[model samples]
Target: MSTPALTLHGVGKRFGDVQALHDVDVTVESGTVHCILGENGAGKSTLCNLVFGGYPPDTGRIALGGKDFRPDSPAAAMAAGVAMVHQHFSLVTTMTVAENLLLTQHGLRLRRQDLTDRLDEIAQTYRLRVDLDQQVATMPVGARQKVEIVKALLRDPSLILLDEPTGVLDPAEIDALIDTCRAIAADGKAVVLVTHKLGEVARVADAATVLRRGTVAGGGRMSTTSIAQLLTAMVGRTAADLDPTVAATIGLDPADAVTHRVGAAPTSISGPDAAEPRSITTSKTSVPMGETGSTASALTRAPIVEHGAESVAPRVDNESGSAAAVLTVDRVTVHRADGSTALNDARLVVYPGEIVGIAGVEGNGQSELVAVLAGDTPVSGGTVTLADTDITTANPATRTGLGIGIVPEDRHRDAMVAEMTLAENLFLGRLGRFRRFGLLDKQAMGRAAKAELDRFDVRAAGPWVPMGSLSGGNQQKVVLARELSAANLRCLVAAQPTRGLDIGAVDFVLTQLRRAATAGCGVLVVSSEVPELLALCDRVFVAYRGALAGPVETSDPAAAQQISELMMGVAA
Candidate 1:
């Protein structure tokens, strides 16, 4: 093909002692979608950063159209016709969409009128629509992501790097993104997508590369590779020993069930950002650790699920009085602090010993529902009953007291205080009993925190260390341990619990949630990942336009397809 659009030879990167990427080689031709697939810390992001110049590679050569290419910064990369759309948005939450759009161009060169006109022109040209005057903070997650994509496209880069861009998008929005990439490729641009979601890779990738432990495992023309082959490559397993997909492809075989194998100390790997690479922390809680590839880890890590995530397990109705619901919401309505209606008569129920899911496009009332259930938000109407007690007006503390535990959507903002010690944050809400004679008992709290953290196997400098000192997965472990282990925790609500976690952490969190349900806690899992919801939830409900749809049983073979239609505003 006419000189590959981008190429790397023997590229390597290191963050301190972590070798994030080693001898990496990749090439992208124009007019194609090249997918870089890997588990978290598999060096995907490091490669992207290497190419984008967030940090220079430790060793390597980069070429653009057969010419020497080296960039000192992201701006220089963009100047060379490369743009990156990060996983998390970088927009000014306070700015109007139109303003954000205009700021990218030369300052003072375009009037507001000109910017609006440009937005309109691009909307028509790209077949993408966005509200120009709306504050990004108020837009739905899907819309905000669309704005991010538009921001990257506005620069008209010849090569685009998309990092987990569809993590928060709905099926329709994801399809739109794929179509846009195709349109861009048709115009001879190159698209490099770095993602852990195997289904997306199977659907949109023209060529694929798999990374494991910062090294390329295998890759080839997408047409020549089967999903099974891709999974085998990504997880370092054989077709028979292949695990999750192997089970799903035939049928879930408990005898064949597998978990992550024990991996040693944190190695050099790509992490959350360019400055810091990821590290591994072994949790030694009571829970049995899985092999190198645990069932949950393998399933979430690979494209094992036919629909792209794990599918249903038998509903476990093992709680006392199993038929009785632990939590119920009747016609709940919620308004945002900004005065926008968030949930309109949203309703659902969580029965003991069962996992229920709230599935929808991001920004479609899932967050509000979680807040309302967690007692963090005030309701405008409707009633929430916890074990037959009216809790609509209960405060967060009251909810917690009534056995309502939440692993909030934003763990940092709602679940834990980053600046506080891990012990302090773990026992933050339930500190009343720790006080003795109106005086705080430091020794008692320390002992309790250490015992509890050790039980959850949360690795940290010590219980005295800041909560933020741990990795994302370990941080999540702290949350899961606290909530699930709470006294009289009859029900638990977790929102996007695995949102930013790696496969190892994802597996651990899901396992904990399941065990909590098995032990009689009603569990509510709110996530944008349909595959996850399909795989783990016993029952799934679609949240759309601030409303809850049918509670589809996950046991149905077509559950994923049905959920997709419901999320897209169609009745399954």
Candidate 2:
């Protein structure tokens, strides 16, 4: 056979005392989609970085087509017929699609027309749809992802790596991506798909490899194994069946629970200094049912109502007693830079132990809502109360001090400082943990950061490397590790907490959100993906063209459908 497209032998990585990947070996055949499966911190992203030359491995040899291959940087990797489409879009928003696509043109400047024409041809040929003339920022998330793929394809790579390509896509968009991947493989390029979603694996992958604690757990053809078997290999256990109590906690009507995943793993709360040899269990330890006083606060009604029920009685939690709201927003209006309205008189509330989801189409004020909650932006007119304290006028720092942690919608631009070290990034504003006499305690910070990194499974070249150096998926883990470690948090504002994470990471993040709720903290998660909202939130509020259409209880289909239509701005 033609030399394996890419191979790694005795690959390993370590940070101070943690061994991220150890004596790992993997081989990818030409023109086939190879999958890397693992739970959060399983070193999936680490392996990708090493392959792409983000940095050299601590110990190992990488070969391409029977020859030793070593790329010094991303540019070198591209030169060696390897390309990566990061979990985060790397295109500059201000640049036109063509300009970004052929950015490196030549040592000398090239004609813009030539670049655009060539880009158009390539786009059409690959069936990767994108408008060459459009400014990248104007495109939706799914479209932007397409641009990233186009950029990679332009390099004419023989090996392509897609890092969590479906994380930000809607259900329909995911289908398109699946088709695109199929086409890419058909082109005879070796493809490495790094993701944690088992469904995605079942849908598009050919052969599969499982990584656990930085080592290869197993490998097999996708067609020969079941999703449950994959999960067992990745997490080192037969994945736990969803606890019936979890379905009740999320207010899933028993009927609805049957269709969706119930009681999988929870989101991760560990920091960057997480231990090496990551745990295989993806689910967080479940909060004892009703411990947060949520047992009687909400009721679950069947998705289908009995024909004789009078007007469908509202589900009420008998155990939930009247309690002061921790977060309250009233008649809030958000406006664009040009004075156009984004959110008009929208209102919402969340009590402690409640996880509220705000769902809408892209560009429908979801970003604005997250900004306002995180105190990154000021609302034009509204009341925002946190623990009965008016925080409408608070700054981002103040809100954070008041015990609100935010996993922003745009992890790169809003949440992370690219040039900073992992340790510094994690301790962004809260330096108390590593400050001495008002001076930064470097040693303490590194140690602390290492602990969180291992705990959260954040993959990076080194703790001190610039944040921008790691893969997008790993960067997201850094953001999660930092924000969730806030000990005094009373509430959290997470916008797409699992945006670029793999299936294992997805489970870890959801579990963390549940943990926060169980600890009596209020959580407001805003996402465009409806299924994510359905799976994680205790209640969902639909937004349409900036209006708070309806706060739907997740108990029945009628309420969810009503909210769904409102999300489309349809009349009830």
State the local distance difference test value for candidate 1.
Answer: 0.72
Our tally of clashes for model 2 stands at 32
The window of 10 residues in a row where model 2 has the poorest summed lDDT is: 288-297
| Cα lDDT, all candidates | 0.72, 0.70
What TM-score do all the candidates reach, one by one? Answer: 0.78, 0.72
lDDT of 2 by residue, 187-257 (tens): 88889998766656656778888898888877666555545455556654333333222232223332222
What tens-digit string does per-residue lDDT give for candidate 1 at 314-362?
3355443547889999999998877888899888888888888898877
Error of 1 at 266 (Å): 34
Over 4 Å off, model 1: 111-126, 237-315, 318-323, 336-341, 430-471, 556-572
